[model samples]
Structures are given as C-alpha cells and as structure tokens.
Target: MHLSNQGLLVILVVGVVAGWLAGRVMAGGGFGLIGDLLVGLVGAFIGDWLMPQLGIHLGVGIVALIINAFIGAVVLLLILRLIGGGFGGRRRWI
Candidate 1:
C-alpha cells in the first residue's frame, strides 16, 4: 500500500525513534537522529525479508512494524560492530 506524505513522515519519525531505542537496548549505543532513522528504514526492509526466511511471520500492523524496526536496529548494530563502528568498550553480547 502506498503511503501519503503525512503517513510516510509519521512512519519515518516512528522508525527513527524505534530504531534508536532498539539500538540502545540491544547495543548500548547512541546513533543520533538521522542515523537511527536511516537504520530503521533500512531495517524495516531487511526485517521483512529475513523474518520469513527464518520461519517467523508477524503479519502486518504497527506491532509488526515495530518488531521489524527492532530487528533491523539489532542487525544494523551488529554490522556496525563488525565493521569497527560501534561504541568502544567491552562487548556486551557474544
């Protein structure tokens, strides 16, 4: 479904916040506003693609989207860490 401009804007804002929160919770890092938003938007697509491949389906809704955002943020943080871009400190998760 195509989103109106306002809808898209709302989604972007939500995605940014969700992404930042997810990153904080999962990686203990601050990605700033723009970075969070970009990560969220990209994460949405990646989550949608990966979930099904992993035999998990959340259907579609706000909740599903939020789950997607969280997954995406986690994935992005992992990638960032792998590339030596994560916050410098002890690794929290192994």
Candidate 2:
C-alpha cells in the first residue's frame, strides 16, 4: 500500500524494532540496525502476501501493521534457520 511520509516513518521504526526482536528471538541477539531494517522491510512484504492466504485478517491500524510485520519477520527467521542457509546461498531450503 501507499504510505504517507509519517506512515512510512512509523513502519520504518516499527519494522526496525520488530526485526530486532525477531533477531533476538532467533539468533540470541539483534542483527544490527541495517540487518534488522532489511528483515523488517522484507517481513512486511511476506506478511502482506502470506496473511491473506492463511485467512488471517488483522485489519488496519498501526498496531495491526506492527503485528503483521513482526509475525512475518519471525517466520522468515524460522524458515532460514530450518533451511540452514544464509541469504547468500542460492538454495535456502533443502
């Protein structure tokens, strides 16, 4: 969706926080600012795509957005872990 400047800022901040949290949960620490930001941004895309297929509708609002992004980030991390591959790897899954 198209976000205004303020909305984008909010997403950035939320995504950073959510990514950091996911990193901590998965890797035992934060992935640094840039790493976290990337994860969060990608997570937003994942959530936007996956949530609908899963029949999970969080609706709108800042809280829903944050929740969606955070959940997606965590799922991405988990998938990465299970696949035992880094982002540079051509095959992320076995």
Candidate 3:
C-alpha cells in the first residue's frame, strides 16, 4: 500500500519515537536522531513481518504501529548486540 505524504510523515514520526524508546530501553541511550529514525523504520518493517509469524497481532491504528515498532526495535537492538555490533556502551555526560 502506498502512503500519502501525510501518512508517510506520521509513520516516520512514529518510527522516530519508537526507535528512541527502544534504544533507551535496550542501550541505556539513543544513537542520535537519524540513527533512531533509521532503526525505527527498519524495526517497523521487521515488526510488520515478524509479529504475524510469531502468532502476535497488534491491531490497527498509529498506537499499534508504535507498539509494533518499539517491540521490533528492541528485538533489532538485541540481535545487533548478540552479533557484537550494536550501538552499545554508555554515553558520556559532561
């Protein structure tokens, strides 16, 4: 399905938020705005595919999309860590 400009924007925003949330939950921090957005978009796609195969359904609407994206992002981060290439390590604070 093709999303309109507005729809795409909404999805992107949701992805950014979901990715940031996931990063914080898994990595103790985010990988910055662009990184989070990228992770979120990929996570959204992953969630869209993985959830069904795992016998999980999040229903429709933006909220569901966020939840799906968040779950997927967390999984993605975990996988990346297991592969020894995730955005790990603590952030430096001055």
Candidate 4:
C-alpha cells in the first residue's frame, strides 16, 4: 500500500526505533539514532524478503515490523563487520 508523506514519516520513525532496539539487543551496545534508523529501515526490507525465503511467515503489524527490524539490524551488523574487514579474520564478502 502506498503511504502518504505523513504516513511514511510515521513508518520511518517506527522503523528507526525498531532498528535501534534490535541493534542494541543483537550487539549488546547502543547504536545511535541515525545508525539505528538506517539499520531499521534496511532491516525491515531485508526481513520481509528473507523470512519468506526461509519459510517464516509473520503477519503484518507492529510485531511483524519489529521482527523484521531486528532481523534486518542483525544482518546489517554482520554486513558492516564484513565490509570493515572485522569478521574475525574470515574472508570478506567483497
């Protein structure tokens, strides 16, 4: 569904908060505002895409959004680590 500007803003706020929470939980540390928001937004999309492929279906709503955000944040963190060449001495993805 298409979101109006206000609706999109609200969604973005929620996504950002969700992402921050997820990042804190996964990383055991704080991810500042912008970082959390970006991760959350990306996480939302990643979670939505990856879950279906993994046979995990979450109904749409706050819970699903949060789940998606968390998954996305985790994946983002992993990617960031790999990109920074900090994957514990493992080969980088790129």
Of the candidates shown, which would achieve the greatest lDDT relative to the real structure?
3
Question: Over the stretch 1-94, how does candidate 1's per-residue lDDT look in tens digits?
Answer: 8879998976897688768877778647767788788878887777878888999988777777888777976787788777985676776776
Q: List the residue pairs that clash in candidate 3.
A: none
Worst 10 residues of 4 by lDDT: 84-93
Over the stretch 1-94, how does candidate 3's per-residue lDDT look in tens digits? 8879999899889889999999889845788999999989999988989999999998999999999999998888888887875555654577
Lowest summed-lDDT stretch of 10 residues in model 2?
Answer: 85-94
Clashes of each: 0, 0, 0, 1
Candidate 3 lDDT at 25 equals 92
Name the regions of candidate 4 deviating beyond 4 angstroms: 86-94
- Give the per-residue Cα lDDT of candidate 4 at 7: 76
- Model 2, 1-94: lDDT tens per residue? 7779997799798799778877877754667899899888888889889999999999998778878888889898888777976444265365
Alpha-carbon shift of residue 56 in model 1 (angstroms) = 0.8
39 Cα displacement, candidate 3 (Å): 0.7
**Cα lDDT for residue 61, model 3?**
90
Model 4 has a clash total of 1
Maximum-TM-score candidate: 3
* Local error of candidate 1 at residue 76 (angstroms): 1.6
TM-scores for all candidates: the values are: 0.76, 0.77, 0.86, 0.74
Q: Which residue pairs does candidate 2 place in steric collision? A: none
- Give per-residue lDDT, candidate 1, residue 72: 73
Ranking by TM-score: 3, 2, 1, 4
